[model samples]
Target: MILVQYMTKSSITELTSNNKKNKVVIHLSSSTKLGHYRASCLILFAFSCVSSDCFGELMEDLTVLSPKAIAMANAVTADPPGIDSIHFNPAGLMQFEGDTLELKLATFDLKNRYSTGPQQVDPTVKASYENLTQSPYPQDPYANQQGATSEPVLLIPGGSTETVPFPIVPLGGAATRNAQHQMVFASAVYSPMMVGFSRPDDDLGRYQGNETAISRITYFSPSFGFQVGDSLALGLGINFSYQGLALRMENRAPQASAAILGGLLSGVSGQQIGPGPYDDVATLNIAAEDYLSVGFNLGLLWSPLPWFTLGLAYRSAAKSNLEGDFSMRYSHSMQELSTELRPIFPKMEGVEFERGEVKMEFTTPQHMSLGTSIMVTTKFKLNVDVQKSFYSEWDKFTFDFDQPLDYLVFASLLDSDGQDESLTLQRNYKNALSWSIAAGYQWDKSLLLRAGYQRRNSNIPGNALDLIIPISDADFYGVGFAYSTSEDSHIDLGLGYLVSRYNIDYGQSNNANSDAPLDLIYNPYAYLPIRASTRAFLLSVSYRKPF
Candidate 1:
């Protein structure tokens, strides 16, 4: 006799048949099956939602271009700055005495670590699955009722830590022709906002994103500055900007579970079956062609006394309409699943493999700064600066696709309305503020020393936190020096370190797809607790030559 049992939320039943002497007993738990099935479905939901968009922290114009400024933690706003003043404080260009060229190179080494609490599960759901029973029937009628309950599970076998390195280069030249008026002309090229990160393919956070590389904001500025009087100067520049981006992410698809189920059923029926019907991996890659945009910068410098100076600078946001190619590919396992299931489930074939045009609009955000430099002694000076970034302007991102994806499988399992040709992710970033202070001592006519510190606040909220850009409030410390090789040439070297950490504790109950079927999937275990720590070192060098 063979007994087959199917348990539902309402009742449990067993079917007995008299066919052969040998007996086979199979038990199925409704809750356990549903949990595993929902887990697989969540993968599909996440993949479809992020396939067409690029994900990362918004770019801030916080790059340090001048080795001297960086050594001073960027408090050079009111100092007699160099050609890098094109970004720090254009009015400082007016102080240059002759034709001067400056070139700078910097390296960034960053280390990041992520940790999470145990996986949380719903407390109400009593049992998931119980040990298999070999007997035809349980000795006690209630024996079958004993089942395992859901509990916290660690997605990542172990917390992960990674370190990455990046290089930065900036070039600029400034010339002052009229000694009396101190009229200056300057031009420079530099990266204002650049970010890149990559994670292992098997990272548990792969669903959010695996790799993000963006050069999306580079600046080419040409400017003019003039001394208005012995006490003040003014400067202005037109910024020609360029933007580019590339993003990649991976997700588990519904076919993975479907294939496993098919394999299990085939085994029961005494039929030969392959490993599985679905592939467990799906990847999305998007690259945008470089685009051009424009913005402007204005600055003012005031000297009330020979030993003190005040400076103000403002840079407008860069805006652009970007177009690019969107491509997606599934693992071979997925193709195998499609072939194996086509006869039974034709609709599952040829899904999620497509290529088309993608478009989106983006903005870089504006920056403003105010600073002062005070000569404290014959050979010593103190510099301080406060800056503001209008990150609030970046509230959300929208991506439009030429063709919509067939998210039918997701719709059915997650009980969704269907798929759309466009998707939007909420950023809801807040404005950020930063301040720096530094002191420089002129040891002699040929040597100088500098030291400084800075503090910056994070702009992202917990709900928007992800692996691609795990940003947090940070503190920076720096030290540097300058050596003059001749009357017209000098070299500058600077080193800096930054440290930050943040914790996120929130419920995913209000996420984009957290309704209806999806709601059931998250229910009692939507809360996630995660912690991230970051450390970075910056090394920079610059050379200046005046003809």
Candidate 2:
């Protein structure tokens, strides 16, 4: 049976005394659970504040450009259409004349699945606790043959090299194991004289449980444009954005199998580890208030020839002031535990505790894009865009501790060495620049075909450091079609597919008998090959009387 203990300590010293198995006391003073809570908050704060989006493989596949623009580009020449092309190549918008405007709406069905191999677990740490409990001792046991020393055979249940004791996930909560899927989109465009807007709602933590989260990355903007001359166009835009976040945490235990525990322990020999309250659940509710912010975009589109167009766009960065309410729901049994569980399943003695709220703000990065498109022939055209992410803008997250026992609490868990550090989490984000190239062919004035490729690198830390961002390389393939039904009526269709694969090396930070703590040794595990594919079909009819 998996057992979890929650306790409050007077100081880091109190934690060390009862830590028999020396489960790296999370933070240092409080139980590992609390330390994780603080750490997760700190990390999210770091990501939100830093221009971190640029570093991941996810950034390579999707851009701020709307789906309609991507679809149109894929359907014909990557020429700009609608104002959306301003972010890719504003020059496409220069093709519009008279009182012309285009309105398009789209949805992005985003799904993310994750899995890791047990080999990534630490064998020499508390994570290896299960090895001690396997049943059916090795036959002709090495122990019986005196003086003949050989490497001891360690058998764990179900072939798991080590079992995680308690919970010391350095990558936030187990909730990450839960799959996340959602849909969000924006549709807006303008002419040389008028503008309009429509933005779909964003769901944060939709995939990680119903946690409250302000989508720090959500964006909404409206824009206006004017023609400078036959070859040049200028546009200005205003951005209004909002962010809110809520993290829902449920009390959870390690994913230890009963068979593994049964075989590891000598005291509970031959006893079946039955399912019990160890699998119960409790909830932690975290709510961050919504914050409003503003920014702007400036763009220019140029077309020196009918076959070639170039564009540039810039967006400003803004900060959010966030505040929130935090509370936890406790299961009856969890509330009764007076001692904390260490790595070795040892119990800490005489601990007490209380819970409360956490608050902070996260920064979203600023970005710029330069794009170009060329109609190589009457039937074929190529388009390219290069963009830069301002990750340096994100730096640190700070918090205030006003509780009576805050000092003792912080010291024991987060800063055991008495560094007297403020509640600040540190991180560095690498600024990233990425590019995309696409090509399309026209079979007739009424028929078109397209195909494209894209690639991006990852931003995960080295094999030695453990961080939560699971960035990796990504590759893409896309095709689209457009059919003209009549001189004034038409239908359009497009599809895009993206694939991401990773051979990551992750370590379990929970090993025993070593300064390294328990670490899941490095091994390769393939998460779900992320797939971002889209299918879109559009129908429209229009008329223009001679003006």
Candidate 3:
């Protein structure tokens, strides 16, 4: 009813009439067809839900801990320290004394949690009903028990059992033993040992059981800084980062659902399936890229009463365009299952696409931070900082796809709602916000300890309608130490951890035809409860020298 009402009121004819009568046309422009507009909207809507993917590959594995190393030790800044500051808080350069060069190497260890159950089972149910209506003995006890109905039925001979093994289906009559149900055969290889089924060659099958693995990401950062005035300094840092990812996934037994068994097909396969999810290997490569950006900082040294100083900084967002290669590959056994059935390979193109030298940019948000420190004694001092990111400026992203898929398949999956409906504009739906507070204390000049916390808002929407982006809100906690090696040299080290979580929600609409082959209109009416969490650990070490 809602779809019908919206279509009628906003129909092209209706829109044309409104345009002729009114001088100001509001909604969508008349120049573009509602279909294309809706398609673009759907694409953009999907992008907004996962804009985080737009950042360069390294960011997928990195997070900022404190704005600057000294500030990190003093717990005076919201963001993390290191060359990352050139991107997050350039104003941190203000504390530099004379001229200095710094170099750093860091690594990130990440733990991810993702899991999902069935989504939208209506189609399977409807297909079952259709099969029952075509049973051979429609009114027979067997047919009634299978169909749970006493209606007349029509039967048709299915595929050649040996030539194309159709699954032994309860629909249209008992499916021949050799019935070729490729979908079912594929499932058998996946969840080999679910309930009654057992896959003896589980290790060789594509759909192996549950699997887990870890990934290590590394970064190289170097910076040069010099003082301009009594209290101001400027610096430029070049950040180069790379990622090495290893993944293992367990496959579920393929889908051999039947109108007769209601998922009872497992009993017939008796294929010695393993006692768990199957296992498969995956490798993802992220190339190194250099980010060229600069930072500026200012400090005010004062002795109003001999014991206090104040600091202020405005960190501009590092304007950078990062370009790198992102590639992924996987090995599985599902393709082999087809050999036993049709002696042919099923062509699946989109599900396994990889990217190369994808150009992406990370435009850090403009930040404003204020800090104040007071000496309580000759050896003890405390510093505090508050900061905010103009995350709203983190706007839409542009991409140049090295490979484009078939238009029909892409359209069918992304823009199936027909026309006149969309959740977000394609290019402008992804923007986020961020903020943080920090404080640190110095017990003695030689032994300094630091700790800080931060929070970020998610740019993803609740509609859960994205294709390539992934967004999540995150929180961070950190601790660090600094040691004075000599008069002109110092070493600083920090450890930090961050937690991220978000949901992926979507829904299917009725009122669209059920019998039509392409009636599955995924409207994303609501955000489903999709919760994925990641625990990340950071280790950073840096050496600073005065020149």
lDDT of 1 at 289: 42
TM-score of 3: 0.48
Tell me the lDDT of model 1 at 176. Answer: 50
lDDT by residue for model 1 (330-390), tens: 5665455445544433344545475677667777678899999999998998999998878
Model 2 lDDT tens row, 1-547: 2223333532222222244443342222121223222222223332332222222224322433233334433222235444354333333443433233333333232223333233222332222232333333211111111111111111121211221222111100000010122111122322110000111112211112332112333244445555666677665666565444444333322222222222222134344332111232234444454436565666676779999877777666755565555444444433332122223333222122334544465555676777777889989978787767666565545644334222223233534432222355444545666666777688898776655655443333233121112234445555555566655333444455555544323332211001222111211111111111212121221122111
Better-scoring candidate (lDDT), 1 or 3: 1
Output the better candidate (1/2) by TM-score. Answer: 1
After aligning candidate 1 to the native by TM-score, how far in Å is the CA of 168 from where it should be? Answer: 6.6
Candidate 1 yields a Cα-based lDDT of: 0.56
Predicted structure 1: clash tally: 7
Deviation from truth (RMSD, Å), model 1? 10.8
